[model samples]
Target: MKRLKIKSFLGTAVLAFLIASCTDILNEEPRSVYEPGFFETEEGVRGGLTSMYAHLRYIYGNAYFYNTTQTGTDEATYAQSADQNFLVMDISGRGDITPETSRADVLWGNSFNNINTANGIIENGETVGISDALIAEARFFRAFDYFMLVQTFGGVPLDLGAGELAFNDNPVRVSSRNTVPEVYTQAIFPDLLQAVNDLPDNPRITGGVTKTVARLYLAKAYLTFGWWLQNPNNIPTYPETSRSDPDGNDAQWYFQQAYDVATTAIDNPGPFALQDTYYDVNWAPNDRNSEILLYADHTETSEYYNDSSLTYANGGGADNFAVWMMTWNYTVLRSSSSNTEWLGDIESVRREAVQPLGRPWIRMSPTIGAITNTFDDKTNDSRYDGTFTTVYRSNIDVEPAISGPVYNANGMEVAGGDPILTFLDEEPATPIDYSLPPEQGANVGAGVLPGRPDFVIGPNDISRRVYPGLWKLGVYRTDSGNGLGQPNAASTRPFNIAKFSELYFIAAEAAVKGATGSRSARELINVIRARAGMWRWDNSENEERIEDNSAEMVAATPSIIDIDYILEERSREYFGEGYRWYDLIRTQKWEEVAGSYEIAGDNYGDHTPQTVTRSIQPYHYLRPIPQGQLDALDMSAAEKDTYQNPGY
Candidate 1:
């Protein structure tokens, strides 16, 4: 297989036609005009493989289907749909999902498209005497797509071989949803193992799949299987009637496998390493730093390649959907040239004044306890700096000087603004008064509170006004070097988050599961905490806080070890990366913790506490398989009965 010399056969007319139709059909179909003979050579195999890769890019880049669904219910974005039904049922809390509204159909379809492409490549490549290594890469890609499918939708239609002509007419969809464990053991694991065996440890190709990539995928599959299927921790098993019958212990085992694979990848030649400074390498557009172990390498000329210019709001590129989804919040506000000082006074503003900068909306709100408890110790954590805004300004300083002409609702400068001026001892210096309206005198911003404005008020003066319309996550770039003078400044001003610090938390969890040392989990957790600039356990304040050191704390703290701590760390680390909802569900904490926070001013009109309680029901554990596929299936009574997971 390695010795096979694949050749390229490009018939002139056929090749010309492919070139003509290439741009349009590249994403949808590649085989409509080309015959099997066209793919007989090495160059042809490369083109076919490249086509498969294009599908892979599409698979990952479907931000709306994947990121929105994940972030909507997960941790970052609170569902603010105007429809109460959509907010309460589809998001906010888990509820029975109608197949019609569910987005699983898109995930299923997109994944299978990649799988089908992989199948074509594998089958045709073999016939053309393509090397075993190429075949292995194809297999890895196929297995990965399937893994995503099975995890998401339970038993998806398994298409190991190429679809037959009759597949459309008399399609035979596989019955009996493969058990999660069975899928891991039979399909996912074998394919990955074979891929690892057949692929080079470090291939000559710069960006193609390698053994390390295969290991990473395999490890993740094993870890997930261990947790959901094996239930190593002896936690309550997911009932057979559940959408995906998962065993808690199996989940633990899968996590361990993930750690092992990550460890191996770390130890491999040209091993994975953390980027030195979170701000410099990870956040910068520069890719020279190759801390990324496995990533899609898109050259500057490649359509998939994204640069700072491509991501900039004024650069005619779409704002990163991930950044937009993660950052959109009613309480966040953008600063404008008209109000430079307003940026400093976001802490005292009301929810109405907060306007989010246009970006992918990714959010994960840490519990108040989570924030306060970790605050002092983690004051220096790179993540803390990257994730939250700490500065604030007082309202008194933000009020416009009395000397400035006051502008009314219609923007006309009004004469003689109220001049009692009890707040300041000196007469107002400016004619305009930008004081807060009387209706909103006492509201505080989400994170900070404002103090007295710059004006020196009379000793008896107690009135305080805050600057409104402050956006958190407020980083931005000006349109021109002339600063805020540019007309496009406000309109084109955009801020989107790309690199998040929470992946480190996930890596820590994986490490703990795969640890060989006596305190491997603790060590891994501690390393992450340290990276986050959290205080050591021996710190005086932390010691005092841990006076009782309950098992949960002890387990989470360095003194003791528990998975719960891992979960909590994950919650903190990945707060706005859209992992919260999934983490909560996986750890069985959603119902218990969902109602703790009051809905301050949700988009859905005034939902009462009674309306927001989320109880963990078995049905919600797995989203229902899309109904469209079910409609197409020809099912006998027993087969249909046995196939669908119980709750759905």
Candidate 2:
């Protein structure tokens, strides 16, 4: 049981990664015998393990990975930044991703680098004198990296440490891609199996990876292998699809294995459970709840993200990464800035402008069309409004009292003026007939009717529009004092990686795929619903279960189960928690899943209409290997040709 104070320890790992120079330079792929002796020591082995886990920071700490996984799916789109042109790659076929794509490069480089480190520990396990538990931990980390690689860039070089390469050339030169199935069978499965056998049921430290986490990953790996085995998706790459069954991979068998492994993790009862309410899941200050299975712990000292140059000066940390997914930065009609005359009280004005949650970087936008229509029952679904902010209070006094100043539609300082605040849903009929406009000085932007002395505060001009701001992860400070060094740069929000609610979705999906039979899909989904206060399960949990609940509540009995029902249930439970894209990808519903949405105003809703049409392409199943890696490959053109992902 070693203490895993791996936060500051990760700094060493980050330093090890020289900024990947897209073409000629790649992240370090250790020379065979350069540091062999160091890994032979007990302390060295521990350091190696910590550093290996530390590479995950490059993945979770930045918005790149999150956006790579989320944006362009039916769930969300990246903001239209003047410089962020690559943002188009997520949703539309506009961007032809290549080796130079920064996202692809970091993911490919860091994943392999971590795996290479894990290989060092695993290869020197006996000499290092580290216990079996440590070895198991290392193996899980390696398998986890491969899982990401295979999912992103199909078959990557399946390199396990060879204490010394048979040929002493460059190590990463083997950018030779393997088939999708090969990465799984060779690296993911064997490594996870080693992890399952050697790791303890739970780790000694909080935030440390546990055997349960390893097992869950194993289940997902198997599920992925099984699903990808049949070539269900990847239609554009038809005959040459990366098939595995013919290469001795059993599709059905792995599905069952996925279910079995997931079941074991699910029934483990090791302090993890679903929070009774969705809000409680992201409610900071309570991050160590039962719902979160694995997360990158962020502190000011050991920050998850540290590159804020993307949004503002001094604004890069794991907290800022969460802000990237937020709808926080809309101050177009925010009371503090929107109010010039100060007609409304301070509190009401503040409430009208800001949603009081999530500092909106608006870098990534969640679509309003999807928000209104995605839910199975928009009215009954608690997540519909709870997850998105559509209605906003008006900061200005839209309607005046009897003695208030009256002005025509134009604000001409009439004696009676109405308070200029109302719900977007219940907007005033006559263009907010403000006879006298609130005197916002010329510097401030206000509305005035043409040729009319009585100026009007028109809704069309102000930033008050009915769009959904993502509030799934709550707000950090939205000002320059955002605590991440820059004002309104990043927050103290911890980025969530996995949750128990997802486990339920995994189980239900596994069940739907004919893998598990422990619970019907309805029963599993009903458990989540009862927690969200959406709908109660039929069979109520015992009094004891209720006492230990997220809100001290329990589920009732279940009903008939089906796949469609489970999918929608997932939307209700884990809307913006970074699960949508992967879910659609795995379910083979990308085409119908990502309806082409022309977001006119803003991803955070600047009162613009959104257009959604089915927009998934067959070639999207696998992202292209970053061209930088391909150019760096010592292999021939033919080799590179075969190695690039299909259709790329």
Candidate 3:
């Protein structure tokens, strides 16, 4: 593929922003682009390094990229307000995931651009008196981007218009692809190994790379590469080569290496450990806690530092709008101002920039399997409550113009801070009245529970238009005074990329793949499960709920742990964080696990589910080389066709 103006923009324009605007870096007049000589200076090396960290914002927080990682997976599907971007990803015959349509392009362009910058820094950092530790940061990120790329697109070019892993000054019109093994063994493994040895234990900045994270990625890469070598399901890899490793290691050797590295990281955690409870890991107030290893950060204080408008966000690149996808229109549920009857219809749940409420796009919703199968034990497990906004409380008090107690579900009086709508954990003994009209206090087709003052929907009744919202990633702001605070603005919270809790899961998964460990797969998995059972604060009830069901959770695990069980635990632990597609792909279980899923229709209150089948063929495993790349390549049509993946 050809390096075009887009790559030039990444190298030049983005560097200027990193130098002048990034709070951690020096302040200078912003230049439109940088020259080849820039990196020769110490300032340029430092500035390019900062740009590597900033580049994450262009990928992780972009909602379209988030959809590509999820929507078609078993965790989620397209919702009512979904456009073509969300629909095509569903793979349910809405539209084909063409080269033009695939959102994986976000990963493609941004990662390559960052890789080129990394190449620039690595080449000149030592000559300019930059520290080895600082230079290793660039190495870590280079490997990081390559790891993501190899997994997503099978094989990618190591040379971006230059020699292999060399800095390219001039844009080129021709490119060649590397083999999968070559990309992993040459590009990813070497850098990660060097980064682990050269990096510091603690981060230099608030959210910088460390040896532990390096080890984590190294172990993860080894694990994923081992799976590719095993080829249990006979999945085809592009730029195809033998499944053999270049280093003469078999799949078992790599799996054991993965287990060893992961366990080593676990034993030697410098500044990282799991949070006390599962809720503490994801709760908005507890962000940047010890559990989070790395994140793409944004500040609520400064518009410049936040990288977008603090008061209003257009929801483009650098905007954390992924949480908006699964959120339904909770603002539509109404309450009565008169206690006697349902006359004054007031919107009880106003949109607020809080953990439970944010701007709802309603573009994606969870599958029934995610709710009913993966998170089956809602009573004992705290993850279900922590992951979703099950109970939406009244926020009328924030709107000072409004007054008086409002009547709800049973014509019962309620004020602010009371539950207006509750997605019930279990079906109540009394049948829910799904046919009740809006005038009779039923709204959004949600059924009414007898004598309850909150509109109720059981887990089975969750539909495309109205369902639980993703609470873990919901908006949080300290500036919302007495009114809804910047609900329309993209979230300023840092989007977490890696967590400390994943070490255990990685080790356990490696063990399941036939590597013996000091702790068995069951032992490692139970550690996460036991933590999930402990709850210090209940999000839905809006109160402190001290409960410890660790033993119960431990007892619930099957005697023999398998890959499927590990995937289930992963979904429970890291739901809605864009990890599903990779996990399913790694195990080669995408078709078996997510081939067909059940969800309700788009209309509100329509709880009847229809099974939707996806066309997840073997060739679909590797996303198509983006059409933009094909258009830029200086080659014939046949060469371009040969360059693309088999199916698309």
Candidate 4:
């Protein structure tokens, strides 16, 4: 009776097919290939489904896609490191991404691996009495791959059947990349709608696709597509430009479709439900709960480890989702400076393990505002607390050195190794509040709230005091509170790619955009708000207010249904579960929100000023086609040139 950890199933017998060892991604098979009749039996179908999941896992499980999603977005503060390639991609900003840049190559070249495998299953599912359920599962994954591809690269090669690659007897691989709309029409929609239509009534399939998963993805696809229809310039050219009218006609229809599908998923009452506690969706005991519709399934035993022998440097434990997001280079490490005398290990109390629960990458820094006021009921909104650690506990392997001339928490110069430290949970929850708290009220700047600065922090700026550590995935050594079982203690936790609360936002967005769903935008949103422990606002109030806990519990509510308000709610709920970048892109707020990433540090103590802008451009909307793939395409020079995305 062990929990089926989403990352625990890496090495089991049947699912071994999920692990692909060779660099030869999508164009061909994995280390092991399923020969001809593999899809004919129940076992085979299940295997096929696992293989597809494995391929999908390759993209989301680690930092690749996650890092790309945050960079310049409002949801992230740059944690620029020289070695992390993807971080540089985010740092590169708008026009700087040449075809030579690796961003497109990694995403584009490998994604097809998912698409082609799903194709193999769909085309041959019926051969060995594969149930309609299994067929639908295959289609659901295929749709999932295309949806991501279109969003990432404007238009990509859409292969519904065994791609043109299989047809040629001779092997000079050449293929045409489809236009974005063509992808939506020819691949994404056909597969998703069919999966939705064919899936059985049940939604509980344990790492496999279910009826609700398909519909949720369908709703998402239509919603993202609707954005392009309204603002064609947001994307490059799509083949079906005729269908996207400037008038509200086509855009409204797409919005309605998104609304309809998301509403059905919500109203149907499938296994997916908003968990009473927001953090449960990502942590154990409930990582595999109903709230998560789409996720990479793993089991407790199948732990991914970073084996040095493996060809890939970051080997083995590919299952862990936290590695890509965490930045736990202890701020306590004191380095020696050249040409300057020891100058007494200078100022600042040791925040040795200020955020010891998880190794934070410090990449996705919530803006001072996001940490403080994004939620009207900041305290009640369990999401803020669930997603981040506002406090630092005294938990680290090394004690601060008893150096002279260093100021501790009290800003006093004590020389001996001060063995004392405080553990504060949700300290300074009035995080970055715009209205400064009363001088005497709420213990202003006390304890860790006013602790010393973090040493040598992010590559983006390299030094700073503290920002709340993203604790959503910070299950340090399974929360043992020490790095003891770390290094290979399971890194893979339940990573939710899609959640039930999103349906509420989808319905809300659709309603605000002029498409009515099964419920009013306010009503749909209220359900999510209530679960997060928020309060409702009076419709005509000059400003929002709850009962101030003077009375029994209540939920804080927004005055009206507007997209900006909805966006903030989404930020509060979905934080680091990985949707910030796309959410901004779809909403056309990328420029305004994540406009310029900043990098400023060198000497950042509690108040020595931090932040300097990084590059971001409008055309950054679509990532470039991986130059390697475009160069590798089996097409004419002109055709290949056409295949590369607009700028890069």
Which has the greatest TM-score?
Answer: 3
Candidate 4 similarity to native, TM-score: 0.75
lDDT of 2 by residue, 1-648 (tens): 323332221111211222211100112222222244556666656666655644555566456666766677766776645124335555454454554553656566566556666766776777757788887888888888888877776666663223221111124444345566666777888889888878776655566667778888888887777777655655543225446564464777787888788778878847677766555576555666877877654433222223223233243322335444545333344222222343322222222112233354556665544554565343334455456544333223422222333332233333211222222322335453323323342112333344443222222322212234565555443332412223244444456777766666666667777775767665666667666653321111101212223222223323555655665667666777667766676667767667676555532223345464544567777777777666766678987777776666
Candidate 3 per-residue lDDT over residues 362-381, each given as its tens digit: 99999988888888999899
Model 3 TM-score is: 0.96
Candidates 1 and 2 compared by lDDT, better number: 2
Rank candidates by lDDT, best first.
3, 4, 2, 1
Encode model 1's per-residue lDDT on 1-648: one tens digit a residue. 121111111222101111111111122222333344445555556555654443433333233443433433323223332232233333445433556555555555445544544555666677778888987887887778767766565555443222320011112444335455555565677779889888887644544567766776776566555455543433332223332323334455566656666556545634334454433222324342444334322222222223213223332212222333223232332211223223222222111111122332222222223333323234244444334422222121223322332322212222321111111211233432334432222122211112222212211111111111112223243322322222111122212212223233444556555535233666556645544442222121112221221233233456655656777666555444434555554545555545333232332122122223444454555556666655545676566545554566
Q: What residue pairs are clashing in model 3?
A: none
Candidate 4 residue 273 Cα shift, in angstroms, is 1.4
Candidate 2's C-alpha lDDT? 0.53
At residue 641, what lDDT does model 4 achieve? Answer: 71
- lDDT, each prediction: 0.40, 0.53, 0.86, 0.53
Q: lDDT for model 1, please.
A: 0.40
Worst 10 residues of 1 by lDDT: 13-22
Candidate 2 lDDT at 68 equals 67
Estimate TM-scores for all models.
0.62, 0.75, 0.96, 0.75
RMSD of each: 11.3, 8.7, 3.6, 8.7
Worst 10 residues of 2 by lDDT: 537-546
